[model samples]
Target: MEILSKNLQLLHFLDKEDMAGFWKLKMMILKITSHSWRNWISI
Candidate 1:
């Protein structure tokens, strides 16, 4: 459900060609994934 909303927001951003927002979102996801990976490795 949350993923759906994020997808919709992503679509809207792309429609507006919001590169800064898109890049920010991309960086946020990357940061989250990397953080999760580090936690998993620590365990």
Candidate 2:
């Protein structure tokens, strides 16, 4: 849920052809997913 919101925020912030923004957004999404998975495993 949080990840989805953050992803939407990133998409809203980034313009087309903004490679750096895309890269950052990608990394943020990956990190968020990884974090979520870790949390689920710990629970």
Which candidate tops TM-score?
1
lDDT of candidate 1 over 1-43, digit per residue (tens): 9999998887776754577777889999999999999999999
Give lDDT tens digits, candidate 2, residues 1-43: 9999999898888677796777889999999999999999999
Full-model lDDT for every candidate: 0.87, 0.90
lDDT of 1: 0.87
Worst 10 residues of 1 by lDDT: 11-20
lDDT of 2 at 33: 100
How far out, in Å, is residue 9 in model 2? 25
Who wins the lDDT comparison? 2
- Residue pairs clashing, model 1: none
